[model samples]
Target: MIVIINYGSGNLKSIKNGFTKIGEETVISQDIREMEKADALVLPGVGAFGTAMEHLESYKDIIHEHINNGKPFLGVCLGLQVLFTKSQENKGVKGLDIFKGEVMKIPEEGLKIPHMGWNNLKIVNECSILDGIENDYMYFVHSYYAKPDDEDIIAATTNYGIDLTAAVCRDNVFATQFHPEKSGEVGLNILKNFVKSIPSK
Candidate 1:
């Protein structure tokens, strides 16, 4: 079973529908203990950084435990941002520090603030979650993106004036700045890949 965390700040229904469409079992709950029973956990979010971090404090330790133990983890949008050490937005609020990095706002020199549209991903490294998903368009809607301390952790990148981290994975922990749930077929395939890659319970 997969657990979609519901500490608030996510398009819960759309995320659930995405998994359900792929025929995967999932439960949306704020219960941290439910994570222990999950084959994999997904952190989906949309909104401000500090507020999200505040809500996540209650489950931060458990989330750290889950990812640290190498259980499969997938973060989306603000979900991806919170995996870093800190974010430039929201007065530089601290993140979960799951990976050594900081979130930076996408360069707005020649583009819009919230990169809201489909963008082609430039595959950086190989990972199971991105199998056969290279060069495909994924939906994005965010102002800030993660800049990991380790470039090797970046699974894929997309350009929004400057190359931005689009997807990241370190061991069993995986995250995407784009909403795979709203990216249509390719997006759903990405989620399917994650579900299929989980270690048997």
Candidate 2:
């Protein structure tokens, strides 16, 4: 079973519907026991970084355990931000630190604050979640983006004034700054790839 972590800060239904559209079923739950038994874990959110992390406090340890055990994990939007060390979005509030990095606001040098709309991806490195998906447009909606301490983990990028981190992957962990669920066929393909990454049980 796939579990989409519901910490009171995400488009849970849209994510679940996306999975369902691809002939996969998902459960949206915050119950530790439910998450513990999931084949794959998905963290999808659209909200303030600090607030999301606070609500996710209970699942921190379990999330770490899931990732450390080599289980497939996917994070989207604010979900992706929380995987980092910290963020300028909410100073002093530490992130999950799954990937050593900091989130910063999109530079406001005659550019838009929140980069919303469609943008194509520049595949930086091969990541399972991006299988059969390259240079395809994906939907984005955010003002903050992650800057990993190690560039090696960057999987894809999209330019919006400055080259922004579009997606990241490290071992069993994967995340996207954009919303795959809202990216049409390209998004569904991404989710399908994620489903394929799950181990057979």
Candidate 3:
């Protein structure tokens, strides 16, 4: 089983459906006990950063424990942002600190606030989740992006106004700033790679 963490912020059904389309069983829930039985974990969210983190706080221990135990973990959108140290989305909002960085609003000088629609990725490093996805268009809907203290964790990037971190990974943790569920074939392939990468039970 693959557990999708539901903290009242993610696009739950879409994500679950995406996995099911690829023939992966996923349960959307907040039950830490259920999460522990999974071969992999996925955190997908769309909402205010502060509020999302508040909901996720109670489950952090199980989340961390699951990942520390070497289960594959993937986070999407707000899920990706919340893994950082902090965010400007809601002033003084602290993140899970799983990665060193802060989220910031996309520079608003020239481009649209929420960079909506298709964009191509610039692969930063080789990652199994991104296999065969280099230069392919992926859907994006966001206003803020994460700024990692160490650039080495960046797995891929997309150019909006500037080069934005599209995806990141370190050890068992992998995350994307875009919604693969909404991103079509390329996105599904990304998820496919993720599902395939999950350590065998």
User: What lDDT does each candidate get?
Assistant: 0.91, 0.94, 0.90
Best by TM-score: 2
Ranking by lDDT: 2, 1, 3
Candidate 2 Cα deviation (angstroms), residue 72:
0.4
Q: Which is better, 1 or 3, measured by lDDT?
A: 1
TM-scores, all models, native as reference: 0.97, 0.98, 0.97
TM-score of 2: 0.98
TM-score of 1: 0.97
Q: Is candidate 2 or candidate 3 better by TM-score?
A: 2
- Which lDDT tens digits does candidate 3 get at residues 70-162? 889999999899999999998787798899999999998888879899899999987889988879888899999999999999999999879
Cα-lDDT of candidate 2: 0.94
Please, what are the lDDT tens digits per residue for candidate 2 over residues 1-201? 999999998679999999999999899998999999989999998989999989999999999999999999999999999999999999999999999989999998998879999999999999999999889999999999999999989999999999999999998899999999999998999999898889883
Best by the lDDT measure: 2
Estimate, for each residue in 124-144, the C-alpha lDDT of model 1 and write its tens digit: 999889998979999999999
